[model samples]
Target: MRELTRDDVNAAVKGGSVFASGGGGWVDHGLEIGHAALSIGRPKLLSVDELPDDAIILTCTAIGAPAGRDWQMLGKDYIKAVQLIIENYDGKIAGVMTPQNGMSSTINGWLPAAALGLAVIDATGDIRAHPTGKMGSLGLASSIDYETIQAVAGGKPEIGSYMELVVKGTPARTSNILRTASDMAGGFIAAARHPLPIKHIKKHAAIGGISIAIELGRVIMEAEPDGPEAVLEAVVHKTNGRILGRGTVTTKNVHYSGAFDVGTIEVSIPNRRLTLHVMNEYMAVGDDEGTRLTTFPDVITTFDLKKGLPVSVGDVEEGMEIAVFAIDKSKVPLSSSVKDPTVYPEVEEMLGIDLQSYAFDKEKTIYA
Candidate 1:
């Protein structure tokens, strides 16, 4: 176990933003949570092996869009969400883990852990930000009998109203309900759900994910003095990822459908064109040659050419030059949901892409 320092927090914001792909919460909000947690209490990072197998664990995360202008979340909302979950849970919670790594999601469990005096498990449901809750529900995608209880809190405080919601049901049903709540509560909200034993987390969660992000961020920060190219090289070396392509954004079409922001980004090179699909986060990428280069479960991120920082889809506009990176799934510690074929059908159906056909060999296709 290690105590997180200010450097860890800054690096997380940088690296977490990259891992967010396109859809994690805001970076400023993440900083607030990280700084506050480190201020009042020392946030310790514990690996799953350090805890007893019988220990109870819960996934703490924020739901909704970073671009949701109406969405308002406060520090109290994050703590309140977990407190509500503990109130209903019959078991004694041992620790809290993040659903995914993002600018804010990386720090999602910290505030609650500090306030409630619980350990922050160094693991995540998914290494990258995703739209649906089931995408990060560990291995519960195939567990039809599994029922989860979730608590949500956050809303437009400017309107003088903040709402709290609690629901118990199958992961899919509850996830959809939470998405709807996000729409009604403004746009974004704090959430806690998908409780499991430490044993289950050990079997399905991405072990040592937080540490990986922190270390990767630290490496990138250390390389920054050498230049953006050096930073990019460090990331590729760290994750075995490669730069798929680099070009200016020729076109971008993004639409917010109350709950999710679904869209596509098109980039043009001299002889190649790259197209990306987004549903909160980048899901798939294809080229003008009619080849599906990458898909979910693998890391797909874009960096602005000028600033060299990871750029979210919502933050991108037409004519912005960006570099695209694609990492092999094998290089990263993946949660079970990412490997399960069932969790992907909906995204495939929505985007109309055959992810299964490319799930294994597509990395070779990109490298070729």
Candidate 2:
């Protein structure tokens, strides 16, 4: 097995997450909070090829709304949710596995490496992020059973806080519970789904996302002003992506209605000005010159112009002074529910004056 250093993990998270599609949540924050536990044990790169078939495994992931994740609603929820799920199973956990790609999935999958004191499997079932466990090809695969139980903090019982999925219906039930639980925590959730055979996990998950986040975070932190561009350059090139645009928010037209943080960000650069519409996650980006950018199956994120760090949708404030960038989703694939029209059709529709006219761009999209 290849032995990856601490710094290598950081580079990978920073670089790997550029592909996270905005739905992966922010890699910066998670990176900042990670490693304290991981540093405890010199985590090893356990190879999938070396894993045994009979090894009992437990699955865990960071669960919460991406929208809430930025606001610090995800920490305890990730550990608690997985602890509860593992508790439900009467079997012993021989090892662990991650779900797949995206900043959210990467962070969720790897967080356990340090906290649980378990060996990190090299791969996961799906290669990218999917909103619900039912959607992954693994949900249909043999070996992993879906029997589940759901619990919610409150609200409609049909939308159980947590759901119970039987072996025959584990896949569908988990999918339903995944959305329901996330919404309960304020429209997002983290879940360890489709527990793969220990060996299979070694075959798919983009290993080292946790380490990448930490490394990326440290790089951003170590670099002072004028660092955003360098951090962006390192991440973009490492992930094989391009920087969509970088500009400051000149105006933030924010209005609060219900549980949503709704608004528009008008940004200005030396040469041009751009506008971004946000709801939960950033929906769309456009320029007065008519360069309209929509994210679906791709991610859109806003960051500090001088610092190159990211902030969440729930925490956005007016005139915060920031730079906005769009990451292509074709790199880190999420689910249709997440990348669908409902996530952010405004880039096309709001700009076009018609909603349905801008269908969800399922070809790999993400938004800030």
Candidate 3:
């Protein structure tokens, strides 16, 4: 067992989440609360390689309305979600993993593993953050109607409700229900209940996201005392990512609906500029010249002007000075879900896209 640091949390959050393709919850929320959990008690990072071949590796994901509800995810609510998963399934929990890259899902990824003495494999679905429920992931492929999945929450007596997300299959869609449960309870619920043994981890899943979050956090910490330039350089150097463009947020359009803080952000620096379309999470990022700077699965992180720390997606307002950086393309693959194309169309479609077409190699890509 080892103590997790702010760096480890940040690196994993930033690195894994970018693969979310605008789905995972949010990067900042995960890093902040996950760090808090560690501060209270050292959170352990388990290597999948260490687990027994027969160990069951369950991907604990979060199904929720708002992607940035980490603040409300306190105390036993997290554990309750875990309990639900364990209780619902007959398999023994030997390890933990994440479906989405953001806070709601990833926290339990590392948390359940450390708290329960289980290996936490560094694998996930969406790299950045996405608004759709867990079933919408590459894991489900668009095959499973997003509504048919399950949604769970630990509010007011571990409440659960079902909706007819699908006329057939797991109707009431417990997956989507989880998100609503979190909204009603003021937090998020755990998901990706299907369990797999350690052997499947090596065969699928992103191998090393925890280390990436750590490195990303280190860059932020180093830049906090220095300057944005220093932080920018740190991120670029450490992750081998790129500073697509740097400028002040000139315009911000925000609205609150259905647990999502959807909006648009425009950043202007000197003669260059960029614009980001954000749903509950940051979606498409492009520039005025029609040059789309980023694609799905690669997280686009934004920071405040004064403090170098990351700003939560909920707190982002109009005229907020910020810096947007693209995370390394070393994103975790959706292979686990890839097997079930009916549910994981997004994962399969993107899998066929070939990263080489995007000019991002397997190693890393960093440009300023």
Candidate 4:
């Protein structure tokens, strides 16, 4: 186990943004929580193997649309969410883990861990940012007998939107309730849920995912002084990813719906146009002729060519110059949750695209 430094926080936000796949959480929010954690206490990061098999681990995450305007989640809200879990749960919680890697999501557990004196486990529900809590449930969605305990706290108190809730039910039913609570809390909320044994997390999570984000961030930060090209090149080399297209955004149509940012973005390349389908994050990228270039579970993210930062769907304007990058799912460490067929149908139905064909092929070895 090791204590996280300010440099590690910077690296996490930078690298976590890339793994965010366009919609993990806001960059500023990530930095805020990360720095706050360091200010209060030294948060230790532990590998899955470091913990006892019987230790209970909880997932801390922010739920709701990244683009929501009235969203009001603060550092206190994150701490409160975890406190609620600790107060209500029967066992002694060992540590906290993030549901996925995102600009902010990557460090979701840091503040809670530091302030509460718990370890930050290096495992994650999903290596990349994905929509819905179910996608980050680490295949608990398939366990019919599993009961989920979810705690949520967020929203602006002055606006009468702040609220706290604790629920117990099936994963699907409880997750949907949280989504509804997010909307009621003005579109965003912090959540702590699904305590499980360390052994189960070791078996189902994307191990070492925190290190992946930190390493990627360190590479990006080191290359920043060189130029955008250098940073992009360094990212490509690090993730074994390739630039899909580089061009100006010609059109962007994003809107908040059902606690999600759903829409499309069109970018004009030299001779063709690329379309990015969105449902909170960039779900898929396709050419004008309808040829799918990359799909979700694969890392699909956009970088502001001028700023050398990964830009989320909400920030991409019609005139900005950006480069789209993709790392095949085969290239990243994937948790069993992303590979479970049970989680794809809702997303597929929402986006009206085929994901199961690519995400869950019987012949592919996703979790070796």
Candidate 5:
């Protein structure tokens, strides 16, 4: 176990932004929570091996659409979410883990760990940012007998949006309810849920995912002084990813629907058009001829060529020159949650594209 420092926080925001795929959380929000955690108290990070196998670890996360205009989640909201879990649950909670690697999601557990004296476990529900809570449930969604207990807190209290809810039900049903609560509570909220044994987390989660984000952030930061090209090159080399396309975004069609931003983006290259399907994050990339270049579970991120920073789907605008980078699913360390076939149907249905064919095909190549 080690105490987290400011540098670690910076690295996490930078690296987690890339792994966020498209949408995880905002960079500013991530930095705010991370720095605040450091100031409040020393936030310690521990590997799963350091904890007892039977120890219960809780998941802390933010749920809602990134494009929401009224979204307001404070640092206290995160801690309150965890506190609600502690107040209601019967088990002795040993640590906190995040659902996925995102700008803010990567450090979601830091504040709670710092203030509550809970260890921050270096594991993730999904290595990359995904749309729904079920995708980050670490395959608990597939278990018929497993019940999920989730607590949420956030929103603008002055505007009658602030709410706190604790619910126990099936993972899917409870997750949907939380999404609804997110919409009611100003389109974004902090959540703490699904306390599980360390042993189960060890087997199902993306182990050491936080460290991966930090290292990737370090790589990007170190290369920033060189130029955008250097930053892009460094990221591609670090992730074993390749630039799928580099061009100006010709058209962007994103809109808020339910609890997600669903739309598509078309980029015009020299001779090819790269289309991106979105449901909160970039779900899939395809060529002009309709050949899928990359699918979800694989890392699909866009970089602002001018700034050399990973750009979220919401930040993309028509005529902005960006480069789409993709890492094959086989290249990244995936959790059991992303590998579970059960999670793909919701995303597939939402985006109207087939992900299971590529996500699970062992013989499938990025260009195949």
Candidate 6:
């Protein structure tokens, strides 16, 4: 296990921003939470094999968009959310893991772990940012026997939108409740839920997920001195990612609603155009030929042409020169939900577009 440093946090944010796919949590919130974790204690990164198979692990994440108002996710709330889950579980709680990687989601376990003196397991529900809790629940989505225990704390009561919620039920039921609470809380909220054994994590979760983000972040940072193109190359080389298109942003239309920021982005190349479908994050990328270049489960990131830094969908705007990058799903670690057909319908219905054509192979398993 290794302790996280400020430099590590900076690198993770840069890398996390890319994996965030266009949305995760806010970059500013990620910085604040990361710094706070480092300051209070040593947040240790642990591999799945390091922990006992019988130990219990809970997922800590920020549920909501950064665009809304009246929702205050205080630093203390992260810890409180975890504490609530610990109280609910009558067994030993060994560590915490992130549901997915994002600007803030990547660091979701840091503050709670540091405050509670728990290990930050180097595994994730999903390698990239996803919209719903079920999408990051490993394969627990179909497990009717896996009882879910959830705890949520966020929102400011002054505006009639503050709540500290806890629920016990099926994974789907509990997940929906939290999403609704987040929407009612203005836009987002602090959430902790899903208790699983180390054995289960080792079998289904993406191992070394945090380390991958850190390495990718470090590579991007190291290339910064050279130039944006070098930084772009480093990003692609490290993840074996592909550059879909490079051009100025011609149109960006995204709106925050129902605790999710959804929309589309259009990039104009010299002779071709690239379009990105967004649902909190860039879910799919397609060209003028109607061929889907990349889809969900794979990482779809946009880099600022001048800054050479990864940018999110919530932050992208028209007239900005940017480059769209994609790493095939086959090359990246993915959760079982990525292959689950049930999760795609909501996103497709929201954007009114079909994405099943680009879905990842369902036959693959982490244990394999």
Best by TM-score: 5
Rank order (by lDDT, best first): 5, 4, 6, 1, 3, 2
lDDT (10s digit) by residue, model 6, range 77-180: 89989999888788878899998999888999899999999999999898999888888887887678988899998888788787888999998889989999
The Cα local distance difference test for each model comes to: 0.85, 0.48, 0.54, 0.92, 0.92, 0.85
Encode model 3's per-residue lDDT on 249-315: one tens digit a residue: 7787756544555667778866877877666666556677766566444566675657654455565
Model 5 CA deviation exceeding 4 Å by range? none
Candidate 4, 351: how far from true, in Å?
Answer: 1.1
TM-score of each: 0.96, 0.62, 0.72, 0.97, 0.98, 0.95
**Better model by lDDT, 3 or 6?**
6
Clashes in each model (backbone N, CA, C under 3 Å)?
0, 47, 46, 0, 0, 1
The 10-residue segment of model 3 with minimum total lDDT is 160-169
lDDT of 1 at 275: 91
Give each prediction's root-mean-square deviation over alpha carbons.
1.6, 6.8, 6.0, 2.5, 1.0, 3.2
lDDT per residue, candidate 4, 238-338, as tens digits? 99999998999999988888898887899998889998999999988888876778887889999999987899987899999999999988898889899
Model 3 alpha-carbon miss at residue 368, Å = 9.6
Residue 125 miss distance in model 5 (angstroms):
0.7
lDDT of candidate 5 over 1-368, digit per residue (tens): 99999999999999999999889999999999999999999989999999989999999999998888797899999999999999999889999999999878999999999999999999999999999998899889777799878999999989999999999988889998999999998788999999999999999999999999999999999999999999999999999989998999999998998779998999998889999999999989998787888988888899999999999998999999999988888887788888888888888888888889888884554562
Put down candidate 1 lDDT per residue, 229-313, tens digits, no spaces.
8888888888788888888999998788767787789999668999998888988888988877887777889988777778888
